[model samples]
Target: MTYDLLIIGGGINGCAIAREAALHGLKVLLVERDDLAAHTSSASTKLIHGGLRYLEFYDFKLVAEALRERERLVKAAPHIIWPMRFVLPHGNAVRPWWMVRLGLYLYDFLGGKMTLARSRGLRSSDAAYTAPLKGGHKGFVYSDAFVDDARLTVLNAMDAAANGADVLVGIAVESARREDGVWRATLSDWRTVEARAIVNAAGPWVHEMLGSLGVNAASNVRLVKGSHIVVPKLYEGDHAYILQQPDRRIVFAIPYQGGTEIGTTDVPVERPEDAQIDDGEIAYLCEAANRHFTKQIAPGDVTSTWSGVRPLYDDGASEAKEVTRDYVLELDTNGPALLSIFGGKITTARHLAEEALGKLAAPLGFRAHPVTRARVFPGGAITDFPTFLTQVRQTWPFLGEKRAERMARAYGSMLAEMLAGVQSEADLGSDLGGGLTELEARWLHDREWARSPDDALMRRSKVGLHLTPAEHDRFSQHWAALFG
Candidate 1:
C-alpha cells in the first residue's frame, strides 16, 4: 500500500508526527522496531517541565516553548500529568538564592499566562516543606507537571490508529530506497511498502537510520545517558525536591508510586544500548539524596533503576550537561522527501510534532489545518480528574481506591469504556496480581498493541514495580501461554 507518510520510530516524536499526519487526512504508517516507548520515552525523569535551570544558559526560546507545551499537556491529560511542586533548598546551594530567584522570575514570565502557581519562597519554619531536609533549610517552591511518559507515547499511537493510521510494533524498515517519486521500503517482517515521504524519527538511531538509507544530513546525534534510581519513600508529602550537587548539576527527588525516585546523572556514552547503570552512577545518586534528605539512602536502599540515552543534537558544547534540550528538524529533500528529528524532550513533543508536520507540508505536498492543539488525547477529556477519580471509586468499589485511581490515571475517561459491563470482581476476570486483571491485560493486548506482558507491565503501566518477584515471574509465564 502507498502511504502519505511513513514514520519510522514509535517514540514520542515519531508517534506524535504520525498522529498529526493522520489527523490531517493523510495515510500514515508508523512502524517501531520494538514496543512503543520501549526506550528513552519510557525512561524519562517523568516531568513536563520547562527546565528552570535553562535560565542560567539564557535559553529563553526553548524555555518558553517548553512552558507553553507543558501547560497544554497538563490541561489535555490531567490524569497522567499532575501539577507537582518542587522545592529547591538554599543551603549548600550551587547558585545563590538571589540568582535562583531571578531565574525563576524569568521562568514565570516566559511561561506567559499560566494556570499553574508561580514560584515562591519557603521559610525554614514551614515544616511541611523542610521536614525532610538535613538542616531544615529554607528553600523555594515552584510548580511543574509530572507525567507518565510511557503512557503518553501509547496514547498518541492509539489516537493515531483511531484516526486511521496503521500503527505497527516489533517491525522495522530493513532497507529502503526512493524510487518513482516514492520511497520503497522493505520491513523486517518481509513486507514491502511505499510512501510519498519518510520520517526518520528513529531517535537514538537517527544517524544509523540515515546510514541504512545511504543518506546523510549536515547534523549529527550525540548520545548522552541519563540514569535514575528508585529508593524507599524519603518523606511524607506529594511534593518533589530539586537538589543541587557540588558539580553544578541538578538531581530530582520525586515521589513516585511508593518510592522516592532520584536521578539523572549526565554522562556521555558511545552507543544507545549503554543504558545500564554502573556502580558509580548508583553511588552518585545515593550520595546526591543523602546530602539533602534526613532519611538517608545507600545503594542497597535502591529498589529499581532505569536508564535512557538522550539523542541530543551535537552543538559542540564542552560539557554533556550543557547540551541543548531543544530539537532540530533536518529536512533533506534530495529525492522524494526525508525528515530527521533530533534532540527533543518529552515536555515539548506535542509542539515538536506540529513543527515537524509543518516542515514537511510543502515538501510532501500535503497540508491540513492543525487539529492536535485543541484535541485532548484519547482518554483525556474530563474537566476535573480528582472529581472524576472520586466518582470512579464510588462507582466501582470492587476495584478498591488504589486500583481505581491507577486505572483512572492511566486510561482516564477511557477507563469506563474498558470496564463497559463489568459489575463485580468475577466479571473483571482473574486477578493477575499487581492490580492487573485478565480483562485489562486483554484490553492492553488487543486494543493497545501490547504484544508482551512486559509491555503492559513496564511501559503502558508500571505494574511490574508493584509485583512481587514470584508474582512477576508467574504473570509473565501466564502471559506467554495466553498470548505468545
Candidate 2:
C-alpha cells in the first residue's frame, strides 16, 4: 500500500511527525528498527528543560523556544509532565550569582512565561532547600519540567495510530530508492510499502539512513555520548540539584523513579551503536555527584546506568556541551523528496514536528493544521492529573495508594483500561518481580507493541532497574513463552 509519508525511526521526532501528518488527514507509516525510544529518547536526563547552562554559551533563542515548548507539553500531558524546581548549588568556581541571575531573568521572560513559575533565591539556612547540601553553598531555584521520555514517545505513536497512522515496531528499513514519482522503501519486516515522501528522523542513525539512500550530503551530525547513573534517593522532597564540575561541565542530580538520577558526561562518540557507559564515565558521574551532596556516591552505590548518543548539529563548537540543540531540516524535493532532521531536544520535539510537517506539506499535497498545540496524547485527554488519580482510585479501590499513584503517573487515565477486568490483586496476574504486575505486561505486549521482555522491562517500564537477576530471568522466560 502507498502512504503519503513513511517516517523512519520511531523516536520522538519520527513519532511526532507521524502524529502531526496523521492528524492532518494524511495516510502515514512509521517504522522503528527496535522498540520505540530504546535509544537516546529513553536514556536522556528525562527533563523537559530549557538547558539553563545553554545561556553560558549564549543560546538565548534556543532556550526561549524550549521553555515555551516545555509549558505546552506540561499543559498537554499533565500526567507525565509536571513542573520541577531545580536547585543550583553555588560554588566559587561556577558562574557568579549576578550572571546566573541575569540568565534566569532572561529565561523567565524570554519564553513569554506562562504556567511555569519564575526563579527564586533560597537562603543558606532555608530548611526546605539547604538540608541536603554540604557547607560553603548557596542555592538558586528555577523552573523546568520532568518527563518519562520513553512513555512520551510511546504515547505519541499511540496517538498517531489512533488517528489512522500505521505504526510498525520491530520493522527495519533495509533500503530506500526513488522509483518513478514515489519512494519505494523495502522494510526488513514488511517489504512492500511505497510513499510519496520519506522522513529520515533516525536520530543517531540519521546519517546512516541518508547514506543508504545514496545521498552523500555534507556531514552535519556530531555524535556526543551522554551517560546517566541511578542511585538511591539522596535528598528529600521533589527538588533536584545541579552540580558544577571543575572541568566546567555540569551534572544533574534529579529525583528519578523514586531514586536520585545523577548523570551525563559529554564525550564525543565515534560510533553510535558502540555508545556505552565505561569505567571512566561512571567515575566522572560519581565524582560530580559527590562534589555538592553531603552523601558521597561510589560506583557500588549505582543501581543502574544508561548511555545515549546525542545527534547534535556540528557547528564547529570546540566542546560537545557547546553544540547547538536546535534542529535543522533538509528537504530533498528533486525526485520522490525526502526530509532529513538533525539536532533536536525532547523539549522541542513537538515544535520540530510542526516545522517538519510544514516543510513536507507542499510536496505531499496536504496542509497539516496545528493540532499538536491543543491535542491531548493518549492518556492526557483528562483535565487534571489529580482528578484522574482520584478517578483511578475509585475504579480500582483494591490497588494500594502508592501503586495507584504510580499507575496514574505512568499510564494516566488509561490505568482503568489496563486494569479492566482485574478485581483483586491476584486477578492482575502473576507478579513479574519489581512490582510489575502481569496485567501491565499484557497491556504493553497487546496494545503497545512490546515484543520482547526487555522492551517491557526496560523501555516500556523502568521496573528492570529494580528487579533482581533471578527474577528478571524468570520473568523473561515467561514473557518469551507468552509473546515470543
Candidate 3:
C-alpha cells in the first residue's frame, strides 16, 4: 500500500514517531523485524530522568531537554511512568562529595518547573535513606522516574494504531530505494509498498539499513553493549541507589519484580547479537553491588540477566561511557525523503520523535502541528497513582489487592475496558497462571499485538518475571490453545 510515511523499526523511537506522525494526519505504516522493544528499548536501565552523570561532562543541553521530557512523559503515562527517588551516597573515591552536590544543584535547576521534589542533601545518619547500607556515608536524594519501558513503547504503538497508523510487527523492510518522487520498499514476506518518505529508526540496525538504502551520512554509530543482573531483593525501599565506581562509572540498583536489579556495564561490541552478558560483566556487576550493599552477592546468586547493544551516534569518543547519549537525526532528500535516527535513550524518545517529524514534515509538503506534546496516553487519565489504585481495588475486589494494583498500573484507565462485564473471578475466564487470565491474555493479543508467549509474558507485561516454571509452561499451552 502507498502511504505518507514508512517507518522501519518498532523500538521506542520508531513507535513514538509513528504515533506523532499519525497524530499529525500522516498515513503511516511502521514495520518491525521483531516485536516492539525486543532490543535496546527493552534493555534500558529503565530510568526516565535528567542524566545526573551527564552533568559531569557539561552536556547541559541534553540534560535540560531530557529533564523537560521526563516531566512531560510522566504526565502522559502516570500508570507506567511515575516519580522515583534516587539516593546517591557521597563517596569521594570517584567524584568528591562537593562535585556531586554541585551537579545535583545544577540538575534541580535544569529541571525547571517540575512536579517531583527538588534534590536535597541527606545526613549520613538518616535511617530512612541509609538503613541497608554498610557504611553510614552521607548522600543526596534526588528526583527522577522509573518506567515500564517496554509497556511505554507498546502504548505508543497502540495509540498510533488507534490514530489511524498501520503498525506491523514480525515484519522487516528488507530493501528500499528512492525512485520516481516516491520511496519504494520490499518487505521480508515479499510485500512491496511505496511512501512519500521512509524513516530508519532501527536501533542496532540503523547503520546496516543505511547501507542497503545506498546513502551514506557523515556520522556513524558506535555499538556499546550494556548488561544488567537481577538478584534477590537487596533492600526494602522504593528508592534506588546510584553507586559511583572507582573507574568513574556509576551503577544503579533498582527494585524490580520483587527483586533488586543491578546493572549496566558498558562494553564496546562489534555486532548486535553481542547482546549477551559475559562472565566479566556479571562479575563486575556483582562486585559493584557487593561494594556498597550490606548483602553480599556472587554470580550464583544472580537470578537472571539481560543485555542490549546501544547504537550510539559515533562522536569518536575513546571510552564507551563518554559517548554521547543524545540522538542525531539525519535527513537525506536527494531524491525522495529519507531520515535515519541514531543514539537515543528511552526517556527522550517522544522528544526525539517530535524532532524527527519536524525534520521530515516540512520537506514532504505535510502540514501538521505537535498535538502529542500536550496529550496523554490512552490509559493515562489519573493525576495520582495511589488514589487511583485504591479506586481500582474498590472496583475489582475479586482481583485482590496485589492483582488490582498490578492491573491498574499496567492498564490504567484501560483496565475498565479489559474487565468489562466481569462480576466475579469466573468472568475473567481461567486464571492462566501467572497474573494472566484467559480474558486478559485475549485482550493483550487482540489489542496490544501480543503474537507470542514472550510478547505477552515479557514485553507487553512483566508477568513473565513473576511466573514459576510450571506456570510459564501453562501460559504457553493456553496461548497455543486460544490463538493457534
Candidate lDDT (C-alpha), each: 0.91, 0.86, 0.90
lDDT of 3 by residue, 203-284 (tens): 8899889988888977789999999999999998799999988889999999998899998899999999899999999999
Mind giving the per-residue lDDT tens digits that candidate 1 earns over 359-461?
Answer: 8889877775668887899899889998999999988999998899889999999988999899898898877768798999999998888998789898887
Candidate that scores best on TM-score: 1
Off by more than 4 A, model 1: none
- Per-residue accuracy of model 2 over 250-357 as CA lDDT, tens digit each: 899999878999988899988889579999999999888877888888999988889999899888999898898888899988898799998898899999999999
RMSD (CA, Å), candidate 2 to true, equals 1.5
For all predicted structures, in order, the TM-scores are 0.99, 0.97, 0.98
Tell me how candidate 3 scores on lDDT.
Answer: 0.90
**Which portions of model 2 miss their true places by more than 4 Å?**
none
Worst 10 residues of 2 by lDDT: 88-97
For every candidate in turn, the CA RMSD to the true structure comes to 1.0, 1.5, 1.2
